[model samples]
Target: MKAARFHAARDIRVEDVPAPGAPGPTQVLVKNQFCGICGTDLHEYLGGPIFIPTAPHSYTGGQVPQILGHEYSGVVEAVGSQVTSVKPGDRVSIQPMVSPRDDYYGRRGQYQLSEQLAIIGLSHPWGGMAEYSLVEDYNAIPMPDDLSTEHAALIEPTAVTVYATHRGGVKPGDSVLVAGAGPIGQLQVMAARAAGATRIFLVDLNDNRLEMAHRLVEGLITLNPGSTDVLREVRARTAGGVGVDVAFECVGAEAPLGLCLEAVRRQGVVVQVGMQGKPPALDGFTLTYKDVDLRGSWCYSTLMWPQVAALIASGQLPAEKVVTRHIALDDVVEQGFEALLDKAGTQLKILIEL
Candidate 1:
């Protein structure tokens, strides 16, 4: 089997590797079809070993020189003896979060909040970038026959956006302000719309990404902080100049977080969706004065697979609209990663077609 393994920063190699032959008692062997290169993968490529462990991880025990990919879809080549959820020849979307042991959070049905959470591609031995990979039978959620494999691969990231909406408590006729136009930000817009948000506002420095978001999502208002006063504009356009009902900081930066805090109405909710590189400086005054609720949204719930898959399959959330390009596994580094990192910000989601 050919796999792309991360050796170090700027060093991802595509070489032949030993195949994951068979499944364990509760495992499933999947023939990977499509995989999406995530922002986490790019962070690892640039300056990492962040999530990719240098030493043995506390949970999965995976280390550096790891296979990189989590957003992917495939067909089940084989299933283990105890696996009854899926069988051979079933098309599935891989829910990569692995909580090998029961914990307080897991006991509460919040597996993603478990302290020893391990992701499939980042910390687990097998990943979807390869032709074949082994996963727990529970990780493989069977897909609907009408869903395309490309769309199936998107279920993972869509889960993130959907969970963010849930975390923000976005309701029908609510107004939403998303402070980023990246891939996740674009998906945030779609998720907000599907959650029945009547008005959606997006802010980003990159005009290209803002244009892409406007084109992909209907009735989206885009704002570039570089040219316009985002806070004033957002407040003016919102109901009674109070501000949006909910605001999401998707850029993971100090400025965007500040924007979200100030743009949201008093007593409104603000969900932090992006992974911040460092602890951002907080405006305690605004938080205290407005009585705003600031919350952090991590990964999706372990049980969100079925609901997310249904949303994408039904076209309520057009996950495919964010896909800018698709390349083969061999071209992942140059065409996929490099293309995404381009300063022009033209690309969004780049899928690796196996």
Candidate 2:
């Protein structure tokens, strides 16, 4: 089997590796069809060992030189004796999260918040970038026959945005302000719309991404801090000069976080959907005076795979709209990862077709 393994920063190699032969009981062996390179993968390529463990991970025991590709779709090549959710020849999207131990959070059905969380591809031995990978039966959620493999690969990332909306408590007729127009941000707009947000505003420094967001969602208001005063523009559009009902900070930066805090209406919610590199300073005054609710949205719930898959399959989410390019596994580093690394780049979700 050929796999792309992360050796170190800027060192991802495509080479032949020993194949994961068979599935263990309660596991599934999948022949990967399509995989999407995620922002986490890019961070590892640039300067990491962040999530990719340098030592043995506490849960999965996976170390560096890890295979990378969590957002993927594949067909079941084989299933273990105990597997019942899926069988051979069934197409499915990989859920990626693996909860090895029954922690307090896992016991409560909040597996994503488990203290010893180990994600497939990042901390687990097998990953979607390869031709074949192994996953627990629970991680392989079968897709509808009408769904394309490319769309199925998008389910994982879509889960992130959907979970963010859930955390923000987005409801019908509410307004939303999303800061950052990257792939996740674009999906946030769609998810917010699906949640019945009537008016949506998107802010990004990159005009290209803003334009992409506009095309993805009809009637989206895009603001570029470069030209437009985003805070002023957003407030002006809202009723009574009050800000949006819910604001999401998808850029994972101080400025964007600040923008989200300032752009949300009084007593509104601000969900931090992006992974911040460092602890960002919060405006205590705004938080205290405005009675704003600041919340952090990590990965999606372990049980959300089915719901997200259905949304994509039904065309309510349109996860496929974010896929900007497709490349082979051999071209993942140059064409897939590097293309997305370009700040002025037009690429969004670049899928590696195996």
lDDT by residue (tens digit), candidate 1, 1-354:
999999899999998999987798999999999999999999999998789888878988878879889999999999999999999999999999988546898788888888898898999888889999899987999998889888999999999999999999999999999998888999999999999998999999999998888776678999999999988898888889999999999878888999999999999999999999999999999999999999999989879988998899898999999999989999999999999999899999999999
Q: Model 1 residue 228 lDDT?
A: 99
* Candidate 1 accuracy as lDDT: 0.92
Off by over 4 Å in 2: none
Please provide, for model 2 over 65-143, each residue's C-alpha lDDT reduced to its tens digit, 9 standing for 90 to 100: 8989899999999999999999999999999998854678877888888878889999999899999999999899999
After superposition, candidate 1 runs with Cα above 4 Å error: none
Q: Taking the candidates one at a time, how many backbone clashes does each contain?
A: 0, 0
